[model samples]
Target: MLKAGDKLPQFEGLNQDGETVRSEQLIGKKLVIFFYPQANTPTCTVEACNLSDNYSKLEKAGFQLLGISGDSVKKQKNFHSKFAFPYDLIADESHEILEKFGVWQEKTTFGKTYMGIVRTTFIFDEKGICERVIEKVTSKTAAEQILEA
Candidate 1:
């Protein structure tokens, strides 16, 4: 996983709106890139909605946020619209962005092993250097976690 001081990995992907978003364009912005396993699931929804509710706080802190999951563009669009998220949600259907950020991993659930995303958040500075990483995310207090970090 990327750690403090690591540079943001170059990536290009489609947002919920089907508009293209690229890593290069985020160069001069303090950013938060959150990787969630799936969209609209209970925990994911809580986490996303918490961030959405705190959108103004995050924006006032000079941070631009991006939520990402392995769902398709249509799914992401629905999730975004359902909650009116202020940030972009990247449709990481190819898992390319997930892998680059090292959030994609093997896991075991109910004695079954599978590959999936481990909910994680990366905080980056204006110059794109990673400033912090939150691996054990708290859905209800996700915004506070980012703000306090």
Candidate 2:
């Protein structure tokens, strides 16, 4: 996992609309990049909606939010549209961005081990340096966690 002060890796991803979004575009502003396991899951939905609910506050604080998951563009589009989220959701089906950020990992459930994304969030400053890493994310208060961090 990346720690505070580490430089963010250069990455490009496809957003819900199939538009290319590159890390360079976010370099000049504070950014919140969150990795969720999948789209439309209960926990993920709560987390995303919380962020969306508090989006104005986050924007007011100069933070741009991006959500990523191993879902396809069509799935991402549906998720974004269903929730009416104001931010973009990256369709990282290849796990390129997830692996780059080190969120893809071995997870355990019901005594079974499997590879999946560990829900995590990274805060990057204007210069693209990681400022904070939130590994224990509170799904319902994600924006508050970011704002308070």
Candidate 3:
């Protein structure tokens, strides 16, 4: 997975509203990109909502938040509206973005192995250099974790 000191890779994808969002547009902001397993799942919702609840706090600290998942555009749109999230959610259904970040990997569940997304959040500085990576994310305190990171 992407780590501290790595460059934020160039990416462009359809957002929840079906509009294209590009990484180049985030050039001058401190970006927090959280890659979740999927949309609307219990834990994912908690983390997203926590960030939404603390949007102002993060913004005040000069951080811009984004969420990405291997979900469809329609699903991402629904999730965004359902929670009224303040940040854009990327529908990386093709797994292109997930793969680029190295979050897509093999995992074992119930003694069976399968490919899946491991939850992670990458914090990047204004110049697009990764500053921190939160791999063991705390769903309920995600915003606090980001801030402290």
Candidate 4:
């Protein structure tokens, strides 16, 4: 798992619009980078909607939000449209960025085990250094915690 003060790894991936978004491009700005398991699933939807609802507040606080998932760009587009998400959703189909951040892990539920993304959020300072990592998020108040952080 990445920790506070660790330098973010360099990576490039596609966003919902198929536009290339590079990690280095987020430098010189505060960023809220979040990782979720899948698109349109219950938990994922709630988490995403929470962020979408408070997007103005988050942006007003000078934080740019970027959501990453293993879904393809096409799926990401559908999710964004369905949820009316105002922020960027990166399609990390290869899990390259997910692996780099160490959010991909072995998980088990209902006697089923599989590799998946553990809901994670990284707060990066304007200098592109990690300020904090939210290892497990299970509530909508996550945005509040992030804003307070």
Tell me how far the alpha carbon of residue 134 in candidate 4 is from the true structure, in angstroms, after superposition. Answer: 0.6
Off by over 4 Å in 2: none
Q: All models: lDDT?
A: 0.96, 0.96, 0.95, 0.91
lDDT value, residue 96 of candidate 4: 90
Model 2, range 64-147, lDDT digits (tens) per residue?
A: 999999999999999999999999999999999999999989999999999999999999999999999999999999999999
Query: Which digits, one per residue and each the tens of the lDDT, describe model 4 over residues 27-128?
Result: 987999999989999888989999888989999999999999999999999999998898889999888999999999999999999999999999999998
Q: Write the per-residue lDDT of candidate 1 for residues 1-149, one digit (tens) a residue.
A: 88999999999999999999999999898999999999989999999999999999999999999999999999999999999988999999899999999999999999999999999999999999999999999999999999997
lDDT of 2: 0.96
Worst 10 residues of 4 by lDDT: 136-145
Q: Where does candidate 4 stray beyond 4 Å? A: none
Clashes of each: 0, 0, 0, 0
TM-score of each: 0.98, 0.99, 0.98, 0.96
* Cand. 3 TM to true fold: 0.98
State the weakest 10-residue window (summed lDDT) of model 3. Answer: 140-149
Supply the global lDDT for candidate 4. Answer: 0.91
